[model samples]
Target: MTKPTFDLQSHSLHSDGVLAPAEVVANAAAAGVQLLALSDHDTVDGVGEAIAAGARHGVAIVPSTEISAVDGSYEDLHVLGYGIDHRDPALAERLRAARADRELRAERMAQKLNELGFAVDDAPLAARRAAGKPIGRPHLAQAVLIHPDNAERLEREGHDDVSSFIPAYLIPGTPGYLARTHPTVFEAIDWIHEAGGLAIWAHPFWDIDADAEVLGAIDRFAAAGLDGVEVFYPTHDAAQTKLLADRCAALGLLTTGSSDYHGPEHRLFRTFLAHELHGYAPDLSKLEQAAARAAEAAA
Candidate 1:
């Protein structure tokens, strides 16, 4: 298979990703990705470093962020903002506030875990905060896995990694579950537009919500000025990809593809390049044009 030229969604240590920004860019270069975006959750703090690495590696980096948002009852929906001004002061402040919320949520999850008799270490969380890494459920899971008090129970339960712990404890209706508080999808789209970026729904099928609910939410988001949808993803089957692509065409919305690579350590899905996009030949022209316009506006 031909290597993909564009991988527009990824993460770095600024969020929950295992790799640093420069490391992620280096890997993208090695994978023959010509265009990339460091769309860290709720933060663009890694974009500057990734851009520098992209320059050195002859890759074009899009300043981007993946914002956690809600659509009606769907609380964990994400919106990817591309061609953003990473240095925008107002955007930075808003993201900082979002990260603060994440921290609070993490603390509450930790408390919940403790109430359930799972002692999670606070030191690791403090270290992550000191390093400016965003607190997330994965971090909490990792803490649980490492804490001496939970080791026996986790081992007996076959909970060996972060992923195993998440569904068992962190998700809604679980013992450590904490409902997220976030802006509406419309508000998130407006935030992206205000930052001179295009807001695209990220990995619609990846959400726990049903496909019909996702479709309905996307319709609502498109009507609210959402710029596009992530049509190609590792988890999307051929039918799902075709469905999203057709929907985007019908709605006059741009369609984009990405690996959503977190790093080698993430076990959820294998990294895919644009060429691996399921059942569809990617046409990134609309996305590129929109990104160009956003960049120009930011400039």
Candidate 2:
């Protein structure tokens, strides 16, 4: 069987995702992914295991991670690092701080939810994953489900999915939202380079504010050493994907695509293959090509 020339971005239990690193890679090989990037949110703890799994399945693994950044202009931004040195001490320290911020934010949000009568304890978020791993809204959402009030609410609303309850109240602009103190976008881009990685603006259309002028922001980010744009993402509708593709071409920026798979509802089985984006093949070759460039530049 021929290997598919595509790289899929995914997360693992190291972050908000449910699967362990090995399970994520196993699913990738099963899904016919030739290349996979375990770009777990704000952490790279799973990259090593994913790499080992890749070797076993004859699939290549690119050590990658995603970081949350506050561009200082936008409400929030996420940066994806490709070909990063997960072992780098500087990179590790940055991610550690970010995860700590996540913990703090979770505490604050849980406090607010309790004020609203959800009465969830912070223990659930801490124990949500392996010890010391970062926790996020998903864990909090699950914690709230165990609360009598929330259980009644979910039953009343007929919600069988925990994630389906998050955005309705926990996300930004909602009752339980608490903004995180993230690194500035420029600092994040530089951190990725310092860690021997190429930085890409990840899921811009989703992470950015709906009313923000996205193209103008992308142009500004390009000046901050943004290497590529995540043009092919599951959340991007066909028209939105095309707009991103055209913007990348106009800006002379590199392009990437991904399933951004987490688990279950966002499984690889249901996600669109990165290469099959409405006849416009996403340029994931940039992953390997930029790997060399990042190393040379960092050296």
Candidate 3:
């Protein structure tokens, strides 16, 4: 089992990755990633920068994004849209609305954290609002816990390190929880399809419900025209990966895998595995198939 020459799922400042879009392209080029996709969260804002850098670095940059959507049953489902026309008016509107909601949620969470005695100022929150990406809990974490310039002060004040801070204190339903609304998965698929892109269900293993529950959602989404299932996700260990692969096969759906890289934000799962990790190495052929389909559709 050798590593794939390219990886499709990744991020940059366009979303929550640690590096800028150019840096991400440069790093991937240096790492020998032949093809790269900067699937930032809800935004294709970095595509131009990534494409320009990829040209210089000798890598192919695919325009993509990870959209959070609610399914028919109102469950949160993430759809990875590839080869999207980022300038689509409807798509841009939705992304901007999502960003606005994120800012509101972040402000509410910050206020709540202040109530909890975390000395976190509104400045970091404000800056994130200005940056224009979704200011979710992770941004809050960067604001309050992980900003390296404040690391010593945070440690002296007894703050948990960056990793633990999110899970321990700021997860959904915690004291500072602020829920943000997202379009339904069906709506997302519709938008992506309308924009002439491909939408695939992301990380089946992370589905909150059991396999049957998630399958039920997938079944309904199939009618709305979902392109594939992410059977090969970074979080899916070997057994889970194989299970999803088999399921997608039986359903006659394309199967795919990716590193889900977010640079420093998720450094652990930043590259494609040559062999199985907990049992998954996505077949990149599906990605190529998706590309072909998108091209045909565009034509």
Model 2 alpha-carbon drift over 4 Å, by segment: 1-5, 121-123, 128-130, 209-212, 265-276, 289-299
> Please, what is the TM-score per model?
0.92, 0.88, 0.83
Which residue runs of candidate 1 sit more than 4 Å off their true CA positions? 1-3, 269-275, 286-299
Tens digits of lDDT, candidate 3, 1-299: 34556667787876777789998888788777776778888887887777778777877766678887765444346888877776678888887876676667667887887777666745766675677766666778767774455567667766664465766567665677655556778778887888767788888777654777767666777778987777766567767777667777767766655677777446365553322434334555645554444334433
- Pairs clashing within candidate 1: none
Best by lDDT: 1
lDDT of 1 by residue, 134-238 (tens): 899989999988888887999899999998999999987788888876777888899999998889999899884477877787788888899899888877877
Q: Report the Cα lDDT for residue 297, model 2.
A: 44
lDDT tens digits, residue span 81-113, model 2: 998888899999999998888888888888888
Q: What is the C-alpha lDDT of each candidate?
A: 0.82, 0.76, 0.69
> Which ranges in model 3 have alpha carbons more than 4 Å from their true place?
71-76, 146-159, 264-267, 271-299
